[model samples]
Target: MDFSDLGKLKDLMGNAKLMQEQMEHRLSETVVEATSGGGIVTVRMNGRKEVLRLRISPTAMGSTGSDLELLEDLITAAVNEAGRRADEAMKSSMQGMMGGLDLPGLT
Candidate 1:
């Protein structure tokens, strides 16, 4: 390859690295919230799919006479929804960074 082509390749690699770093920073800063059971259970997650916070309404935790299984279900639903939101956020961020370029294995 010519020296000019080599220089261009290097520049391309540097740009790619910069974009990756930017995406990582953006993912860390991005946050999403999800709720289940009519907001009885809520979850907040980052674009990395890490749960940052979880909240359960006092009413969601039923009295001693209430059903424990229902509470568990609500929590599970909230967490799953949070994860889905995180995934969507990441996907959207990636698309923006890539400028809609269809990269294999990226989606």
Candidate 2:
């Protein structure tokens, strides 16, 4: 509409962009660790939902070949748990950063 309104809009967009950058940095820095199957399988994931590391205990390989299926299930469980944690952590972080600022098309 008016030039002053346009300037305010520009500022809002700039601030939003800055917040987006900061959130991305925070997400990259955030990490969560989880384990499953009595800690036989462990996974570390970031807020971006990327698995940074995975560990499997030697005990997962039982004497019987049937143990392989159990190991797979354990790994899946561990990864899913880590992903759930990352989602929660990121959501909390975003809420704090956003400070209830529900901008149009941003929420």
Candidate 3:
């Protein structure tokens, strides 16, 4: 193999190791919080996309006229918000690890 090919292989291996470490760190350290129904419902999620906690306000439960609709809307909103937060966190963490380097087929 040429020296240049050997060098490229070394770099690729280094990048793979870096990416693995970064992914693990991100999974363990990142958490995102989201709220819906004007903060009546709240959710917390980890970087691994696991739901950590959920909060529901008493006012949200006590709404009598359209309780089911309210509940559905609140759940949808909270879920969407959580997803948004997760996407943002993932992008930020990946960007930091990547150091502005572009890797096709990786993202």
lDDT string, candidate 3, 28-90, tens digits: 679999998789999998888788888888777754768978887897789789978987888
In order of lDDT, best first, we have: 2, 1, 3
List, residue by residue over 24-58, the lDDT tens digit for candidate 2.
99889999999998899999999999999999988
Candidate achieving higher lDDT, 1 or 2: 2
Clashing residue pairs, backbone N/CA/C < 3 A, model 3 = none
TM-scores, all models, native as reference = 0.87, 0.91, 0.80
- What's the count of clashing pairs in each model shown? 0, 0, 0
Best first by TM-score, ranked: 2, 1, 3
Please, what's the RMSD in Å of model 2? 1.9
Among the numbered candidates, top lDDT falls to 2
Off by over 4 Å in 3: 2-11, 63-65, 105-107
lDDT of 2 at 99: 90
